[model samples]
Target: MKQMEDVITIEEKNHIDELTGLHNLTGILEHLRGHDKYSASEDTVIIYINVMNFKVFNQKYGFAGGNDFLRGMAHELKNIFPDELVARTGGDQFIVLGKSIDKEELLDKLDDFREAVHNYEKGLKMKIKAGIYRAKGTEEDPVIMVDRAKMACDDIIRVYDRDNNLYTEELDKRNELRQYVIDNFESAFKQRYFQVYYQKEIRAVTRKVCGYEALARWLDPTYGIISPAVFIEVLESVHLIHRLDIYMIDQVCSDLRDDIDSGYAVEPISVNLSRLDFELCDIMSEIDKCRAKYDIPKKLLHIEVTESAIASGADFLGKHIKKFRDAGYEVWMDDFGAGYSSFNNLKDYDFDVIKIDMGFLREFETNQKSRIILASIVNMAKELGIHTLAEGVETEEQYEFLLNIGCEKMQGYLFGKPKPVSEFVRSVDCSFENNEEFDFSSYYDDIGTVNFLNSTPLETKSMEIMIKLPIAIAELHGDQVSFVYANEAYIDFLKTIGAENLDRANEIGRSKERDNASGFANILKMAESSYNQRSEADLVANGYVINTKVRFLSRHGEKAAFALVSRNVTAQKEAHSADDYSAVLMHLLNLYNRIDLFNEEGTFENLFLCGNQKALSDIERKAVVAVQMYSDTHIMEADKERFKKFFDITTVHDRIESSGKHYLVDYYRSALPGDEDRILMYIILPFHYNGKWRFIAGCRYMDELDKLKSVLKQIEST
Candidate 1:
């Protein structure tokens, strides 16, 4: 009896996880190998639990924390399935073997596990995804069942929203296709089966071609045109996507060289880089090599990185993006607003252009929320000095809506679908004449900075406020001024000036009588002067005094673009004297050294600066960078680290939610010379403005000792 017990103990010791005290993979396999118990039972089911983003959690909380988390998960699984055989297979995965369980019951168990995971620790967030696979008694091998369960788990694409999936015959077919892709990828590459297609991006206001995004299409001999959704994901899983990215870069560069040599009009072509590209090789060096080999200008080649790629490996990818930018390549963030971390990505990374995710436009006409979100994204991008481009714009109404919201660029089937380079070149050349004198660089710069919407509250009340402020953006060709965009208020103002709409306003600008009018000529002079200087003018048209401000936006050879803001000052001039207006302006200008306004979500909405302090004046438009700059320049060394922690925008929502406070205040010592004895107080106050929560943040000198103590007491109480 003692010898038999020792054998049983040794067997159990060899097949149990040391950390979780649960059956290991070997133990689970051994149990399934027992023919007497499981071989004849057709009710057996296998559940595979994969903790998504576990690696990121490990990186954040250390291996010891990861072990604790695994152990906790093991405990929860045991409690959830007390009668089943639970096993901690490896890493962040677990397997469970049960009998006679239906699909609905299994899914209910998964939901319970997910809820338990959320409550495991306070302030801890993690995703628990599971896959279910039912086994036939005739299948004796356990490995196949386990793998099928894993495959189902891997098929759950949207990790955040989806919890579990069940394996089916369809998954088996997908598995076969994935395997085929893996086998044929290398041969296909060598045989040049991959082709590069160009999709044109159009300037929203002028409907002219601005650039192209290079997309890859697989022309497999057996399958014909393989869907990128299949091949790209397979390649990424196998860590071979870097090779495809490099191939596309080379192909695009070669195409650009051919187009230039052929005397065809060319624009910047953007190529996407996968997250694996950054992990697998020196991608930047490869891009530089391709550019140099083709002798293509760096500006002609743009780099696009998806938001998921950045979210996966930000620090590593950020360094590579800086290298690309330092080498004069414009980097764009593709598929914006596709994930939960969209705002965080905008705050952390410096992207030249943000490509609004096409999913937002899929239900644009049917969903009011989608329209509001899309407009908010464009407005926020414009405020941050980042260019905005909408993807998947296929309808005239969609195009007009995007144009009205200040989206500078558009790419979709409406302009043209992705086509081969040769075909694209022929189509474009036949459709539009090349402007030999058009300065592409200057034009791109101008359209990139132009924003139609002003910094108003981003809410339902925004439309009301926008209607009250008349704004228009115009394109200037010598004396011919054409209005590209005009809001309802601007159209109303035009009607008051004897013009009905944008078309009529443009026609009046081209008429001989209007050309000789002093008001029209004065407006033109202000626009021309705005190229070198900020200029404003007041003119009487149709018996109303209109105050207009003009700012130069861009120049393309003899053509120019300018943004104009007009307000009828008839009532204001009659109510207040010029001296009162000047006094009001002077008082507002002296309010603060610098003031920044952001939404409750921590997106930078607007900024106002008083003095010409170079350091503060040069801060970037991103909130993350703005806080870092302030900490580096103003806060003392000892307080700098804490100051950063206090000002972290990512934590703002959480802090507000937890504390139920609309404002926060803190004090720190100044780091400037001769200011060692001075203390500065920074306050973040939230107020309801235009139907949204807007935060006004500013720092001021805390001169009075009693006031400083009182503020400190208030902060401590909060």
Candidate 2:
């Protein structure tokens, strides 16, 4: 049987790079335009892979090693889709394209890429994570897809490197800058220090007022209009952008209230909150204060956010976003048409409105490419029963073009510039009181009825908002390597026993044992090696060792990627540190963890009081001698005689930063340790976990029933 090579006449052909056998970026773009896919379908996938660690790799290894690793990975990728592509756009990365498939398959293939690439590793290890998405039907352009991929890849790579302690050094440098912005968010914009600007969204047809989008404008003290992209990126690195969101919400709320009080027709201000904020569920109650103080309607204060907060894959995103949506605040999806994964976000969320990034709207008139995408986006929104909004409508051509394409509404410079809250209020025609409700309310059909009584708001501050940092994967190279994705154990260690390695790669250090157990370094190396050979590894470096069971990730038997399980070592690390505590408590804990103490006599024959309580007289030691009688929640006394140096008697819980663990310290002098000169009595804190008592010893005494005999014996001994 003969197979046909389907060929269409290509006026111009793209030359793929010879070494990697991947298409040059120019070739990829040409190919995109040559194929009708970008002009036709709502489902083409475009992903760009950028080698973030390429510089580090080249510096560590020779240039040849870098190329060899990339080429090998490229070869492995080539085999994944025999008919598709593994085009090298140049440098250490490449581009991949495939049209229309199951979304699950797309994601699985990405996972496989992460796994199989390790198989093709060259002499030096090299790995790259990519951002992926379904192309915007016919409106898709190569550059947009590539940028989206870069952004996605950057996000994943950041999280990935975080696990291995790679980005810790950079983060240290960012802390000062982050703090500066955080402390200045409100005041920074004051005195013309920073300015708040609002961009408006109008009704699709009448071009009337919808609401304004609030953006941060840094009126540079030293410079002017400091690039938002650059500074904003820096703040994100330090995780302080949340403060910016807080500042925006607070200022806008106040500004709106003032305008309304002045007899101005100002509805609630629409401010964009970050996914980080929405997920914290901390803004509701705070907003409520502003709502009541300003006499503003909760519904008027619209929170514009990305779709992720509504239903991102992250463990915490959905529940938190619901806090706002459930409370009766408007939640919108901004930059609706920019990213490839927008549809998934749409499917996952209950969005009141969608704002199409102006980029696409600008191109809609002349670019057939934009027309295809705009239609796809508009049509999709129509089907989902969500409203359509095209942002960045700078030209009449674009506005007219959007309408022709079935886009119901648009916003861009052609209409007007983003004004101040007062100016915007003057611009809008509708009054907040008279308006029944906006069309965006239709998304609530799934939300059912909102109960005002049952719903209470969250605690939010103007600058400080509480958030649970989800555990992310971190990686590091060089000697001071460790996990920057600090979990409880890691943070506990930092708080209890501070590590003063200023040059420390990350907060979570790789334990000495991880050298044998194979920590994040080995995990990444295993993944890198996958790009060349089908190899596996299980080595440890840090104390928190992991059995990174790995296999060469390959497509059709060729090494293309690598995948390994990220075993959580939090519990193991804590358990391993048991011996690091006070000798007495460690001894007691040692006796406690292994054997059942239910039947054994709790009192010790030779009671030797040691530590700070040695100076305390006999009677003072009695409080230190506690009996552990209960199974959970220990009762301990404030013993000051012996353990006074570390914790005052009044302090029941003293925080120890060494292991980042909190300690419930019970300090006192106990004569049982012979004359109260030798030892002090200290009972450890105990909490129930997994149907058993987990202990933090030498800190506080547990006055449970189990220790009653020991308490009596100690009293007699004293």
Which candidate number has the best lDDT? 1
What is candidate 1's lDDT per residue for 369-391, written digit by digit as tens? 99889878887787687888899
- lDDT of all the models against the reference? 0.76, 0.50
Deviation of model 2 at 292, angstroms: 2.4
Give the alpha carbon lDDT tens digit for every residue of 409-440 in model 2: 56678767866554544433446542213433
lDDT of 1: 0.76
Residue 617 lDDT (model 2): 24
RMSD of 2: 27.6
TM-scores for every candidate against the unseen true structure? 0.75, 0.38
The residue ranges of model 2 lying beyond 4 angstroms of the native Cα positions read 1-192, 279-281, 307-315, 421-718
